[model samples]
Target: MSARRILQLGNPLLRAVSTPSSDSGECERILTDLRDTLHEFQRTRGFGRGISAVQIGEPKRLLYLEFRGRPYTLVNPEWDWRSEETFRLWDDCFSFPDLLVYVERSCAVRVRYQDLCGASHVLEAENDLSELLQHEMDHLDGILTIDRAIDRNSFCTREEWLRQGHPATRPEAFASKT
Candidate 1:
């Protein structure tokens, strides 16, 4: 498997809504590629939470996420529930290469998705995990954390992002799947 080239911020694919897989067969291939892509991202970037197929030029509703310690593979994922509390956090995107956007997201969430084995799994995540799921799922919806920022000018380059302090706020509500 090859390390798929991550689509940068200006790529139209990052702005377009992804289509769901045509069938389970297609989803299986997406899962494998996504897993490979995730491995590649981890190896090259040293960190990542999840990725959507669209971010790699595949306009399918597929995502692979690792929440803190638990790795989850989601196919045709969707948000089934969300929490009332919201928190703000600094978020970065692989597609954007290296830019930081402070955005608000749910503090807790409930999601439903299909695993590689074709079984369904319901996951509940909070804090960083919840933030991650919301972020990847936004890819499917043609949305990015950058869109949520009230001050777009606050966006920072990778170098500045690293030097910046930790996220100082959180969104009031959070829910996500995938």
Candidate 2:
């Protein structure tokens, strides 16, 4: 029930794929730590929607998110479906809070996951929620936003991005997933 240190980029642990958690008690503890860490980040950094267990040096497939005033806990989540339509955005991560990476993600996605009680549930999301889930799920697979950069110029510091007038303009034609 305490905030844990977030692993930064270049940490080999961040590159290791997370494993599924088999113990409900362990999963619950990880979820609590994630929630605390996310809240701390929001309080100090001013912005953070979701966090994965791997970000806290725990290689477990767990994620905690707070979106639109609602909290979500996902364990062993897997994508059920992804829309062909995609959108580009300046994505940031708690692991690398000071950097913004331009990446593309599905406009809609359906994810299946287990809750704290070990019950399975499905979530259908679009727009912002869809993008957020995709981003966090990537962490479970050891994929960071930087790994999905659109190009060599797809990265910039948070300060530079703000200086550029927050150029998060949507692309006209949606790019196909590669």
Candidate 3:
């Protein structure tokens, strides 16, 4: 499978709402392309953790996220559960190119999705991987993190993100109890 080119911000595809997978055959191919695209981003950007089909100009409900060494595919993925606890962290997207923004998301989430074989699976995720999955899954639903950013002023370049204290804290809005 060939790696697909990523669609940057302002691309219409990134704004298009992706449709869910209809059958097993279509899902298999999308899964392969998703895997290839995930690898391509990691290789070129040196730090892509997840990507959605919409980001590649495909309006199919497919996404891939790399955890450790394995790439996990989530087809028609949705959050089945989310914790009241929330976390704020730095997030960047391939579509947005080089901009990084501090954003808030659920600290722990359980998602349900289908695999290439059409088998449904529920996954429990936490920490950065949890955030990565939710971020990409949002793309499938036509949601971008920028839409939920706590501070529009918090937007910055990757270098700026480094210049800040670089502390990982709960989202300012969530008011988590430590």
Candidate 4:
């Protein structure tokens, strides 16, 4: 239940695709670590909603998230459907906490995944949760938010992003075809 060290952006482990976890015991341990690490990040860094096992150097297809007070554990999650519509937003990650990448994501998504007990479930998410899940799922596939940046100017340091008064407020700056 200890908070594990989250691998940083340049770590090769972060670039490797995570393998699916078949053991319930192993999945439980990873889930606990992800939850603990997510909470630790929020406590010290002020914000974090989700984390992937790869972010902790486990290279397992597991992610844990806490959104709007509810906790979620996604094992071997895969996209079942995505909306044709998309939206632009400033995306951040636990692997690169100091950077903000402006990216586009599906406005809605449906994902099928397994629980810790090996029970399958479907999660349909929209808006913020949709983006958050997409972001974490990308980690399972060795993709980072920076790789999904809308353009070269899509990157900003945390300080610069805050100075700009939040990218959501300046929609014109992120204007690009979705």
| Top lDDT prediction, candidate number | 2
Residue runs of model 3 more than 4 Å from their true location after superposition: 163-178
Going through the candidates in order, what is the number of backbone clashes in each?
A: 12, 0, 0, 0
Q: How close is every model to the real structure, measured as TM-score?
A: 0.86, 0.94, 0.88, 0.95
lDDT of 1 by residue, 38-131 (tens): 8888888898878898888888889987766766778888899989899776788888767777677899999888776677889888888888
Where does model 1 exceed 4 Å of error?
165-178
Overall local distance difference test of candidate 3:
0.79
Residue-wise C-alpha lDDT for candidate 2, range 1-178, written one tens digit per residue: 8999999999999998999997999999999999999999999999999999999999999999999999999999999999999988999998888898888899999999999788999999999999999999999999999999997667789898788687785233532332
TM-score of 1: 0.86
Worst 10 residues of 4 by lDDT: 169-178
What lDDT would each prediction earn against the true structure?
Answer: 0.79, 0.92, 0.79, 0.91
Task: Report clash pairs, candidate 4.
Answer: none
Model 2 bad stretches (over 4 Å): 170-178
Residue-level lDDT for 157 in candidate 3: 78
List the candidates ranked by TM-score, beginning with the highest. 4, 2, 3, 1
On a 0 to 100 scale, what is the lDDT of residue 23 in model 1? 82
Give candidate 1's root-mean-square deviation (CA, Å).
5.6
TM-score, prediction 2: 0.94
